[model samples]
Target chain A: MKSAVKIMFLSALFAMCCFSGNARAYEYQGVDIRGFISQGYLQSTDNNFFAETEDGTSQFNEAGINFSAEVSDRLRLGVQFLSRDLGTIGNNEVILDWAIADYHFRDWLGLTVGNMKFVHGLYNETRDLDMVRTFILMPQSVYIEAWREAISSIQGAGLYGDLGLSDMGSLSYDLQYGTVNLDSDKGAARLLGDQWPFEGMGLLVDVDQINVDYTYAGSIRWITNLEGLILGGSTWGYQFEADATTLLDTTNPMAAAMLQNNPGFVDLVGPLNAYGARFMLSPSEFGVETVSYTASMEFMWRNLVFAAEYMRTTYNIEFRNSPLFTTLEPVLSANGVAVQDGTIEVDQFSSVGYYASLAYRFAPWFELGTYYSVYYPNEDDKDGKERVAKGLDDQDHRGWLKDIALTTRFDVNENWIVKLEAHKMDGSAILLGADNPAPEDPAEDRYEEDWYLFAAKMTFHF
Target chain B: MKLRSIPLIARIVLAGIVLSAFGGFIVPAGHAASEVMVVAHGSVPVESLSRDAVQEIFLGRKTRWSDGQKITLATLKEGEEHEAFLRMYVGKTPHQFKNYWKSQVFTGRGKAPEAFTSPDELAEFVTNTPGAIGYLPQRAYQNQLKSFMIE
Candidate 1:
């Protein structure tokens, strides 16, 4: 309740700030406000096979109201207030989308400060817009939930600019320092209370409080054009993060074992390093006699992008090591294993993925495009960490996961656009927990089959 | 051989008709595919621009002109011939172009060009404003509005 009041007060203050100020009439110094809202109906053949309900269909679906105001030529402020239902679950939240102040010193140098998105690829910064992106599902590797948590946006400052390689090419660079948020924190006290069903007897109210801490990241992008072909390459650098799940109390040994086996659980706290590249070949100027194609391919190398990212989370806890190993085997006793205090530390995790999309303009106002991508995780941990954390079996490669999606858009007119898309996702990581066991099955491989989706959107901007 | 001679007036008329036909065949005027002049302040140093480069600058890809001047692409009112000009030269309708800038504007990715209602106003704005670049009709070229060649 107190938090709600604080949020309201802050919102009011922001509104006043937006409305107040010295009115400037310079050519490049004015405020530009824009927004869009979308509402539609959705029906699902099987709300995904993992869904507990039979046939799933929804009506009166709607998108949150999103708007951005260019406070000045150099600064932008925006937010997304939304209430939407994903399958059966619904959420109402206000996300601070972006607040940035940009300064262009020269054509070759610029700097920005505030909460900003990662410069992972061509679409990473602008992927939120349905109008700009070709696919509804972003390449899953870099944008997967786990990766989103690991490397998406941080509250910090960044430096970005271009270096002229020649008239035809330039190298783009970005460096950022920011803070990451902690999701939740659970302790052994909760587990013991759940197991014994006892209360008032040393019941530790270990509230899972969200934590905000320091984070720094950087990126380098090199783009050049050759014979009408634009080629871009980028590399991402980041600090790691770990999940919030940990056993703080020392009483329960079972909790410690569970934590040891699940050290790789996505820790909301950790350091990360990721990178990727994009190559776009546009044939509009190639003098192609027939249909022209604008083909773009992007590749991302990053850590795991799923709930299992917990195991790879960078925390000070040694959840990966415990007395269970020596207990299981006498020969393992020679390993000199140490009992972990229930924390996980991750040095780094990386994956390689790419999206290949081909768009052909059938007319001046219309175009058709198709794209697909495969994301694979690096299975470096032989301790079955990837399998248990990702819910895959030992047969799973630390780097073996793939997802593909196909999309088509029709520009009905200047003010309206309609898009139809279907996604064929394969892998244990894509599962959003529907038939999967509860969080209790930390090591369970909840691999889902080729789930399909049919969705559409309409947008109007003024 | 048949008549031994022809009337002088008739012969003269025949000769005039033949000469006129020859002249018509020999002299052909070039089609009026006139070049557009991008007018700017004398401070801007540029003589010519490629069609693609012009399109990119006007379309907001290339932010600066060759002379290191920040290129500010402006436009007249909707449905004006300027829309057709942009379409012909930049391969984008004026509405499409504005919306592109609008997206960039609200996103804080780029700056939106100032708009006017008439070529005269645009010319006046461009000529007076530093680092401003605008297009004017060749016929409207005067001492007040200078024109740069855009091939």
Candidate 2:
């Protein structure tokens, strides 16, 4: 089914290109069509960046096409199809990017329904369009690649409008509520699987189903009286639930010997006796709720552009009906701690991130840009000392990541752009566990704290 | 060594400046003027419009003329006159203008304006299409289109 959809999407793209070669704006029966294609290369000095970047990877690419038509003076309909890949992240999956029906009644009232883009900080909606931005890669603090699909767009309705404020300038607002689709092989699933603590003990997890019950996102930007300056604030929340299949591999002689010698382990592994030697944890409930807020500011003058944004997200997570609880219940009880119905409730924690960027169009065809970004996985454990003491992570630097980046862009022509970027990174807080597997020795560290990453990309749009 | 070669570099710079000044006079002035004139189809109702109103129209915020005709936009692919018109009327550079429209079209906000390779083509399109609006060099004015005075 996936391959069939991919073939159809590619055929449509080829047909569109053949029909319109030189025209960036093409119209057929009053409907407009446009598309973009970009390819990128990435290399890192020490650690992998979402893929196998340490050995240099060229799997980063994006292609998209859209069709839109103005049905009437007050109504418009449009849809876009996108395919992108970054190693195991996107996997070049062809999917519906957005399909929306928009209606406008007045300057202060408009409505949109269907799969609509999510409003985040300043650049989320346009992040995939490399031709429109100066940097090859956006600042990772707020635009984390791991969370792109989860927050890219929502399926529901939104109300957006621009309000005139007289001399105070104009204000634009967007309020949306919807659900997001999460795939089993995507980054979210891998990230969730990494949260299981018993993965080192011949345990493996596969996320079977992930569904976001509902999501709410809102954003308001104030185009201040000062020209070329804008201030904005955005907030979003999500309630998600998922089920996973966990298996204990008893084929390993070490696991079998331990199971036989350790009677306490039998009590935990006995309930999950389904497949001869392999135990399974089916119908396990995984629940997560998150709320995030961002503050953003952008200023542009002549050939110079400046932007800064900050975001904080709080998460509450739960794991129920898992063997990890049964295995650890005895330990907790021996330590005079209470266990609640074979369930674990992770304490709510917040992650904070911020970045400041500046770009200058030195010449009509060339631009130079730079930014410094920082992120902390747990704001309360910024130093990572508490997390290390609590045995959450092996390295203290895993709690925070700081990056300094420099980039140069060349607008070869109206239809093509090329960019090169370099980054000096200070930590590895966001690397996924699947990409960086745990070492055999429990005391060994798996990731390096300091590293360097370089990227280059070329984009063509019409 | 650097000090000894300073006079040669200065002389080269002076010669380049002199050549550029001479080259400026060689180009035709009739096709590229100091100011840009906004023009529309001769049958349009208004003879003048505020700069803010023109900006709104070109940015896709204002969709129609007061007389209920759908407004069609025409633009030059790229030139000095095109840059000047965008900067003076829309407060955007040619690159910025292109990026703005691209964002609008891809995001389903609006349709892209028709682009022409020359002022003559742009004027011809504006002249034939009803409720059409575009800009060209002041010296490239023709009687086939009506010019608007920006307030």
Candidate 3:
């Protein structure tokens, strides 16, 4: 709580210092410079939301600076450096957010080579700019925080253009093909391990490295003639391989048969009834292929803006070179004990998410916004019965998450902004296990079905 | 205890809001809506342009003109006339206009148009650069620049 107060005081002090500033025109000659920084606080009533929100963490912040220049009439060069921290994710790591050399041969055809931002939904490209967005946290349903780095940008070549449709309207399209860097210790890898129920059987997997073969993203937006309406669709695909290590306990099903038939396994039996012995498994690899698509619409009239989007992502996974076959099978077979020799199987499934949001600038200093968001980890198993049958979760609420959020944004000045938001959430689909560990009791639930989260943020930009 | 300090912060912020309201502190922009005229460089443009065509140019949709000349856009830094141009011609508020260009820049898609501090500087820029377009107060006078009527 004291940390939260300290952050609030810092933000207020920063806002006061920049209150009298004018609109920034950071250009000299032909180069333009722009940058922004923001700090935020979060507190949740029940489950932790990414950070240690239950204790009210002040560990959310982002900073970025960009430089751009028009080399000639047909060419432009631009780059931005960004650093962000959210709980254990970014850890204040400075990364080359985006750098591109863009050449427009014509309005209908342009080429960009370098690291370019990916367009998923309508707002993914602008998600990092706190001063531009209305919410302190965008809807988690469609924009899962865990996958931000995976889809934030692509490194390779992109083709973009705006085609005039005359009376019909105009169409803007972008196509990019490249690969993204993923950190095994980050949220994406942890989220992947949650897909299978290995931990319940005393088997745990730790990912050490992740590599992407290729990623392709494409988007098209139709700016209709109807004054203030836009329709857009975007899709991206990724193929990843992860090297992992596993730990298996004495009572592991694959080892159960070996222990029962052999009397020489009495050394393992004593501990099997006690704290249990753990064996390390040889390294294995996970092959994952994912495809995600989003359909979006946005409308603006006067000071009011409304947007809605539906997103679905499907993953096909195969784990090969399992410890069950490589490590324990040899030991058991040499002792005339037979063990299961196969890989763990996880069926292909798609996750579904959708949200509708509205924001209105009520006054020069005040804006109000609200959104309703929903997410299902498995589109076909919304009730979670299949998960319970498979020992994945103890409660049905784990299958889906529904959230309603309200935000009030205060524009303290032209260069500074402060915002507060509240969320009412039901269910727990994406809460990670690292922050919320399960109880020792097998029947006990790990997460609460209802919770509340509060957020406050302050941003300064020039 | 967890909830006690939050209201304190809220109260402090509320007091700040009330103080700002009565302190005579001026907001950066409450730009008055007005009739803003579109001016283009004399070297390359027609006398009149459709409203749709004007919106396309400012939004960076149409980068080239009918005569195949590259379109260079100029904008005022911030003022009543600047807000007027965005609202009347670009079909967006000043806030929306700023966010739009910022999105393009940060995403490495495109660069924002050149912005000038005063109408005379903007007029000078438009006059000197070929295929340039800008906006000014309806009565603002300029040299060697063609005025386009928004049909």
Candidate 4:
């Protein structure tokens, strides 16, 4: 698959060069094609820990290459190919990250439909574009392995727009609905010796989620410009999401585990009742002369931003009583515990998280920001211990992480940019449970998860 | 001092010549300080405005006059001196002002002012439209526009 993709890319490039050299093609009026290749190195203070980054601290990192084409004035198409080595562990893979299209209408209304990245906030849309965002790694809480495909991108449709209310203010909104395809099912075998299972495995396949079990989500944002003597702006956004799966297939354990966890699967499959809202205000006055400063304050309340989501997900599990357990209970009465005939398991997951961030911009391309996020998972889950041990209990340790980062961007030229960023991460060890053990006393197991990661990128446009 | 003694009248003449030479340069020639006027097509009353008020008007920070009327602001598309005018009077660069308006455009906060390529075009538009406002070099002054005295 990798070789095929590479061959296709090379042939396409050759054909494009030949066509350009011969026919002298005309530039598409509203269409544009841009591509970039960025590779960087990283050195971290820690290694061999699954904490948050199992990729380990390595000085050798091969970044991804992206190809984006503008379909029209209002629509856009994008493709990203990525390959990376996780330092000394011999783990590397290549995958197609995003293949999507975006649409804009009258600046006030926009829609995106296809397999696309999640637009959680200001960073989501511009995260992959090294030219736009100053950070190398995205905010980690929003990106987790629990639902690997669901966190970064989703396969669905999204809508975004702006609304002017009066002479005083206006609102901006973004809404999306989509599913993540985890696995596909093959009914029969192939003619060649090579089977379907091996063909569908690994980082080579497209974002083709196999199972119907998926995640659904939506977000609404409102921004207002307070036109007064002292100019100020405020924004509020809310996001809600839910996950669903069918666990009957033994071949798919992830799906089975999700179903088993959410016995009330049907009710919690789509649009789980979760929401996040934030209120921020920044004075619009940019002092006299060349240098200026802007300070902002925001308070966020997320019903579920991860870990302890305040929202409750309820599901029902269908089960058939085992004949041996029902009829021959005495025979199964091992070690001292008595066996039950048939048990119907109903599970309710209650989780919530919230945070506050303060950011200051010293210049057009420089900023300092900090955030505090807290979450709590289901305390009553009998499987929390094992899940936490495996770093799957991100939902359990609610108040375990805090992140601070300083970011800067330098526009080298009209079409090129260089960005530098550093991060100070602490707490949230539960989210990194795989790298660390669950604290016996919760407080006594206090482990400082601090690491400094830095990256520089040079981006160019055509 | 005892060896060389000059005539008193000759010394006085020399002192007078030096004073006259100094006086000639002390005052300048063709140095008329020009006065700027706030012009419009229709009725815009002449009112005393502070520099801050004029800065606000030119920067698009203030969109209305004191009498609750819309102000139509105009500008020439290109010129080296026009930028000097903005810098000296409005205290803002054209690029800075353009970016400010772009932000307002994206957030749907305000409408951008119309632009013209030449001063004659600006004058022509201002003459036919009410609440129209524009400025030009003192030499391009005309009677069709009302001169607003910003003193």
Candidate 5:
């Protein structure tokens, strides 16, 4: 399957290059083709920043190509193929970014079918297009990299329209419903694995698959009477189930001895020989439901642009019928409470985040931008003291992250752009557990509370 | 080491700001009163259009003419006249205009306007295409295309 996709990608590139040789071919064929390639470098003073950036990784890059053609007076066909890598996040896997058949019936209504881009906040649809924005990385509070795959696009149908209000300005809306395909090795799965409680005992969880049963998103934007000002609101909901496998690392002497001494552990380590391990935990079930809402605004005037956005997401998670939990139930009951019916229900929680950004084009080719973003993992635990006291987390700083970023962009020409950015972060709330593994000492903090991240990127598009 | 480098970075950024401010003054501000005539194919029915209507047309919001004819848009690649016309009629800078079209085309929202290298090319394309609309400097106006009177 991978080779087939590569062949198709090479064929498309060949066709595009052949057509590009003749500038007039697009005019005659009524087809438009465009693509971009970007290479970036990231370095941090401390902490991984989601991809070994502390060691100054060059694994940050993106490449994409797209083609769109008007098939008829009212119909259009388009598709984009993208490959991106950021440390270990994307791994440079070529995938279908978005493919859609859009039909416009009237000035006020349109319909689109197939894999469509998700409309969230203000810049979600155009986040992957590096040439359009001044910053290499968007504000993470609203556009979390971990959730990119789950919210990037939807494979289904959408209804979109524009309503003109004369002097009052205009209004545009989109409603989309579909399912998202999530990769087992990506950020979302790693984040889920970090939630396992027995990881301290040399137990590790591997997410094999995450299937999003359903996803729905809607957005509405108002182009106000004030020129270059746009106000918008967006919401999306998701329901997903994940399959995970846990293994007890016998390399840990304590864990090995405990397993050897307890004969009941044999039942817990079902069919261990098949996995080529001393103990293979029973397959576990993971379920998640989420609803998120965002309020966004953008104002552009002459050479200056200002944007601000706020978002809140509510999550409900469940871990059910795991052998590890069943085996540990009797032992944990002696100390405190044990798993009930082999089920662990993580109580509902809400996360809130916001950011304000400003950019000014002082010269035609040079622009300066800055933003302050804040994120709280749990709105209920603003300072994280309660979480630390309750033993849910090790440090108080893990509850929230505040970042201040400064960026400079230079447009070398119409086709090329270079950007440099610096960020000073006050907390480490969003670092994935896989990247920053748990420490041997329970009392030691696993992450730094303050750090700096620097990035430089160059992009070329045609 | 990170703390000591802050002042150096700040000095560099400050210097850049000063240089950019100086560069901004050298940029050529296009002629403010240059006559920009909105032109279309002779087949078009309307002799005049509102500025708002023209803005909508150029922004890809209005896709058809009054007679249900498909609107084929032509635009100059880049020039003083192009800057003036977009600023006056579309209320957008050249950079903003390009970014807007890029977003539309890349996102599958709309097709980009056919761009011409010069006024002659723009005039020729507008004259040949039946439902074409464009703007050109007054000097490039010809009899083959009809000029719309801005209301």
Candidate 6:
């Protein structure tokens, strides 16, 4: 199946190149064929930025092709196949970007079935299309790379339409409800691992599977009477349960010393904390529900576009630390640790992010854009004191990340684009643990607080 | 030979073929079409269109006429007349109009309108197709297609 798709993708690319300037006539069975290919390079002065950026890497690239046809006056069908690689993620895997059959009953009502793109903010649907935007990377505060695949498209169905408001301009809305296919070896699973509180309690987890019970996305935009002004609101939610393999690593000296010296220390599996002693934990259940929303505004006049958005995501999670470790009841009674039962004492936290951006196309060939974005993992714990007290991290900067980015885009022509971008980062909030693994020494710096990431990319579309 | 020297129908046909080949780019040094006209098929229900209606039709917002006939849209591939028509009637730059269609096509919303590189081809397309609408550079040729006076 993979090789078949690769062959089709390569065949389309070859055909498009041969008929580069005049691909408009390259239609099959009245189906229009269009796609883009992009290659990029990344180099970061301090931390790895999605890829192995510290040492520089060229593993950033994307290619996609779509076939669409208006099968009837009121119905259309389309599908796109995308393959992208970002660091160790994606690895150039062929995936269905979106496949939909749309039936337009009227201007104000339409039904889309099959797989459709999920709309979160103004730019989420277009994030993968490089020629459509001026930035190499979207503001990560709202469009995180790891979360892109998990919510980029839904496999069920959707409803979308545009309503005319006479002098009040118009309104466009989309609603989707469906399930998402999650990969266990992908970043989304690792992200869940990062959230498990027991990771700090000498427990390490490797995600085995993430079962998404349901996912939904909805968006509405008011195209105001004011020319080029649009105000919008969007939201998406998910209910998920994950399975994982856990390692009870208690060999670290601090964890071991705490286990041996604390009041409950000598009683509860103290031998598991022995040097080089690794124990495989028994089966535990992990469940999480997330609700995220964004309010957005964009104004476009002539060649200038200005946009601002604010997003907040709240999480409700529950987990059992160990089913076989004799429960938290015994430990709490011995050390007064306040574990109500056998569960990790966390149920909720919210993250907040927002950014304002502006881009100007000075000429047909040149564009410049910039934005400043700020994100906090825990809205209640703006400072890292709570994290350190909870043993989640050793440094305070892990609680927040702030970034200012600049991008220069050059449209060599209608078919080709080149871009250069630079980001000045102030914190290390969302850096993946896989990219920056923790060391046994608590005093060691896992990530630098201040860093810079540079990126250059070129794309060709037909 | 001067374009005026040809028969009316023949000129429209020749103009269409030449326009398809060169997008009306190589008109005689001293000759140029003046004023753009919004034209439609003779069977279309509306005799004229408001600017808003025109924009809606070109943007795929209004899919059918009030009388319930499906609307077929025709567009010039690219030319000065195309840019002028989009600016005057569609409230969009030629570049913006192209992007709008491209976005729609890629997103599975709809395919782009049938595009021709010649006015004659577009006129011919509009003439035969019911509920068809298009724009052309107004000239002195006696073409037999319904013309819409925009409000």
TM-score per candidate: 0.61, 0.86, 0.87, 0.46, 0.90, 0.87
Candidate 2 residue A44 Cα shift, in angstroms, is 1.0
Quote the lDDT for A166 in model 5.
89
Q: What TM-score would candidate 1 get against the native?
A: 0.61
Clashing pairs in 5: none
Q: Largest lDDT belongs to which candidate?
A: 5
Question: Ranking under DockQ, best-scoring first?
Answer: 5, 3, 2, 6, 1, 4
Candidate 4 lDDT tens digits, A1-462 = 866765565454345434444212213453222333344444333322222332334433333444455554345666555443333211234555566666655445677777666544333444444443334555444322232333345667777665544443445555556655432211100000011111111101111122334444444433223211222121212122212121122233433353454445323233322221111111011001111111122222111011111122222221222431233233224212243444212232333323444433233333333444433333344334533433333332233444564444444443455555544555443233223444556455334445444444455432
| Candidate 3 RMSD to the real structure | 6.1
* DockQ per model, Cα: 0.04, 0.12, 0.34, 0.02, 0.44, 0.10
Residue A224 in candidate 4, Cα distance off native in Å? 0.2
Candidate order by decreasing lDDT: 5, 3, 2, 6, 1, 4
The candidate that achieves the highest DockQ relative to the unseen native structure: 5
lDDT per model vs. reference: 0.44, 0.79, 0.80, 0.40, 0.82, 0.78
Model 6, B1-151: lDDT tens per residue? 2222323423433343333325223433221334788898888998778777788799888889878888999999778788778767776655668767877776777878999989989998998999999988777323667888788
Chain A TM-score of each model, in the order shown? 0.60, 0.92, 0.87, 0.52, 0.91, 0.92
Q: Write the per-residue lDDT of candidate 1 for residues A212-247, one digit (tens) a residue.
A: 445555555444443223344344433332221222
Kindly report the docking quality category of candidate 5.
Answer: acceptable
Candidate 6, A308: how far from true, in Å? Answer: 1.5
Question: Across residues A1-462, which tens digit of lDDT does each residue of candidate 6 receive?
Answer: 887877877787767767757435357778888888899988787777767888778999988888888888888889988888889888888888999999999888999999898889988887888878878988888988878889778989898888988888788899999999999867787777778665655666778888999999999999776766889999999999888766667765545655565564344443342335755666566788999999999987766789999999999977655543344445434533345345554648999999999986665566678899988889998887888777777788888889998887777777888887778898888888877777667687888888877778999888
Show model 6 residue runs off by greater than 4 Å: A1-4, A20-25, A254-277, A321-341, A439-442, B1-35, B138-144
State the local distance difference test value for candidate 4.
0.40
Worst 10 residues of 2 chain A by lDDT: A330-339
User: Per-residue lDDT for A409 in model 3?
Assistant: 82
Lowest lDDT 10-residue stretch of candidate 5 chain B? B1-10
Off by over 4 Å in 2: A195-204, A247-279, A322-327, A332-338, A441-444, B1-33, B41-50, B64-71, B128-131, B142-151
